[model samples]
Every structure is written in structure tokens, then in C-alpha cells.
Target: MLLKIGLVVIGVVILYVVVQVLLYKRDMKKTKEDLLTFVTKNKKDVSVTIIENDDVVLEWNADQKTPLASTVKLVVLFHFVKAVSSGAIKLEEKVALSDIERFYIDRTDGGAHAYWLEVNDFSEHATLLDVAKGMMQFSSNACTDYLIDRLGLEKINDQMKQAGLTEHDELMPLTPMILWSAYVSDRRRDAFKKMSGVSEEQYKSLMNEIFNIMKNDPEHKKALEEKMKKKNLLGWRIQSLLTQKLTKSTTNQYAHFMKLPG
Candidate 1:
């Protein structure tokens, strides 16, 4: 009777293993088919990854890179969270309203025009987490600009480089007038100076104010200092759709991968 019990236990174990293997294979096949079908259906290119059992499976054009658009916010969120986790910045730390933030809020009519604003009052106070959340949830351009100003554009770009995303642009907040000129003119630095009509000395002074706000956070300050000493300025690489190859389609693949079968 004991021998029979041992055999039964072994049989159950074997059955369980077989079931698990079958499930895994089925899931993988479904995923691959879904990806291929989506790619074929959509005209755009994309990358996909699956994580299971603490292992990552990537299906993508390793050499291909694309514009992140709002996806870049994920990088910002990661750095912000890391700063908080490392005790470099506090979630509850109060950030005083700057003229730029106030101007942006006012220009947009208390954020009613903008999705990022939680409160209409310019006097409304907020914590770092509030700003961070607004940035991620709303993809608030204004909030992102404010945070970038506070964090220092150079530092943010440096963090991006460290995170292994080298092909990302760090756009600093500028006036519409300046933005237009910068966009149209190849001589950006000179065009900026001409558009602002600020003397070199005055420009330096303005930069000082911006830098001062960034220095308020210890982590931001440290990152700024480190960036200044670095030889290479953080920059993004431009990729053209016509020049590159994409094995998978982005639009359909993303939808199919995320969608549940009804």
C-alpha cells in the first residue's frame, strides 16, 4: 500500500509539470501570434517585451529608436521617484510658486485650459508629489516645464543619459517669441539673445535666478554640479522612419498586446 501511495504522488507531480508546460507554451504562442498579427495589420513599427519568472523576453529591433513623445515622462518619473526614495528630495516638501509657474498658470487661465492644473488659485500650494503626479497623469507640459526649470534642464538630460536613453531631447521652457525664433533660425544662441534683447550680463543674471530655483533641491544641485564637470553635453539622436527598419508594428501591436479578448 505504501509503494502504491508513492507511485500516485509521483504521477500527480508529473501531471502538474505537464499542465504547467502546456500553459506556458500556449501563452507564448498566443503572444507571438498576437504580436505578428498586430504588426502586419498596422503600418507603424514597435517594440514589445514580456516579463515572467523574473526574466525578460524582448521582441524588438534592437538598433531602432523612436520618438518618446509623452513616454519621456516615464524617465522623469523614475528620476523623481529615485530622488524621493534616496531621501534626496521629500514628497511633502513645499515648492514656492515662481513667476514662470505663475505666468504659465495665468496664461492658461488657472489650468482650465491646461489639464495639469489641480487648483485655479495662483496662491494654491502643492507638494513635490503633486507636481510629479500632474506631470505623469496629465502629461502636463506646463508642469513639466516648471519641474524642469526647478530641476535644471542639464541635470534632467544627464539623468536620462545615465538611464541609457541617449536619444532624448531636453527642451527648456522659453517664451513663445523665443521659441519661434529658435525654431526658425539655425543660429539659436544668437537668435535667443536677439529675441530677448537682453545684454550678456543681464542674460547671466536671469540664468542665475533659474539656477537658484534648481539649487533649492539638494539632489538637483548635486546633479547640476556633476553635469558641469562632465565633458559631453547630454543630447538626443534623431532617427528617420524612412531610414530604419521595424519588424513589428506599434499601433496594432500595442492595442492587441494590451487588449483583452472579448
Candidate 2:
């Protein structure tokens, strides 16, 4: 009777273990199905990955690349915090708004400039911390550019590399002023194309020559005007473009490298 009872007990233990394994597999399958369904219904041309406890639970097209958009600001913020923690910059440090900085703000749309215009003091002094806050909170382009100048773009990029951020490769060279200038210039070019009868190639060539001269020659302003006159592109709109110059990870690899450690 004792031997029979022991054998029965062993059989019951095996049955319990088998049931647990089955349940675990079932749950995992359900979770994957739900995730796929969610992505299909909610996301449009987006790559997604879900990680838990250092493991990728679900992933789809995770290797695909897409525009970082405002998400890139997180990189800037990450570097800024590191700077503060390392005693490279102080929170109370005051930065007087330079003429160039002010110019960028005045000319660029929807960035630090807009925020500054709303709340800058009579003396135009703002702390380093405040500028960082403005960059994150207000998405201020002016503040971002200023901080980039202060921190040195190369150093920030180096830090990103050392941290092994694959996403940073596409997002490097974060120059807000240049970006704004290009944006405004592109719009102006589009407008020119629509409003003028000149051939697109001819117009582009003329603009390139004038910009090249402006960069290399001290008399670029005059030269620009002359070129524009020759091409019949000279106008307030073209001039404004110069002023505006002021104008992702794969499943397992992504999970390992993409997340920021606390």
C-alpha cells in the first residue's frame, strides 16, 4: 500500500508541472497576438518593440528607421543632465543673451525665441538651468542652439557614441539655426518656383552660386543682389531667406542598447 501511494504522489507532481508549462505557453501566445493586433489597429507605418526585465516580449519591423521628430530632444536633455551631474556646468550660471542669440529668436518661429519673447527679464539674463528647461518645456530652438554652442556639439556627440546609441547616428549634428535657415530657404524656394516663370534648374543654380559667393566673399550681400538681378530672382522674399538662416532598434539588440539606465 505504501509503495502504491508513493507512485501515485509522483504521478500527481508530474501532472502539475505539465499543466503549468502548458499555461505559460498559452499566455505567451496570447500576449503576442494581442500585441500584433494592437499595432495593426493603432499604429501606421510604425515600428514597435516591447521589452520587459531586459527581454523583448514582442516586436514588429523593429529594425526600420523613421524620423526622430521631437523625440530627438531627449538626447539633448540627456547630455544636459550629464553635464550638470559631472559639474561641467552649474544650474545657477547666468547666460547673457548675445546679439546673435537674440537675432535667432527674433527671426526663427516657434522655439526658444517665442518663449523668450514671452517671459525674458528686462535685462535679458537667464540661468543655464532655465535655458535647459525652456528647451524641454517650450521646445525652444533658441535655447537649444545656445546650449549646443556652450557644450560643444562634438563633445555631446562623443558621449552619445560612448553610450552606444544607434539612434544618435541619424540625429547627429543637431544645429537648430542651420536647420531653421534651411527650412525657411526651402519654403522660399518653393514659393519662387510657384510664383516665377524661371526654369527650376536655372533658378537653383543661380541661388547656389549666390550663396557660395556669400560664404566665401566679403561682398556677398552685394554679389547676391547682383546675381538675383541677373536671374530676376532678386526680391524681399529671397532676402528674407538669408535672415531666416535664422530661417529605432531591432528586437533583442534594441532592447539591450536603446533603453536609458537609471
The TM-score between candidate 2 and the true structure equals 0.52
Please report, as a residue range, the 10-residue window in candidate 1 with the lowest summed lDDT.
234-243
Tell me, by lDDT, which candidate is best: 2
Pairs with steric clashes in candidate 1? none
TM per prediction: 0.45, 0.52
Candidate lDDT scores, in order, read 0.45, 0.51
Model 2: per-residue lDDT, tens digit, 72-94? 55566667767766778877888
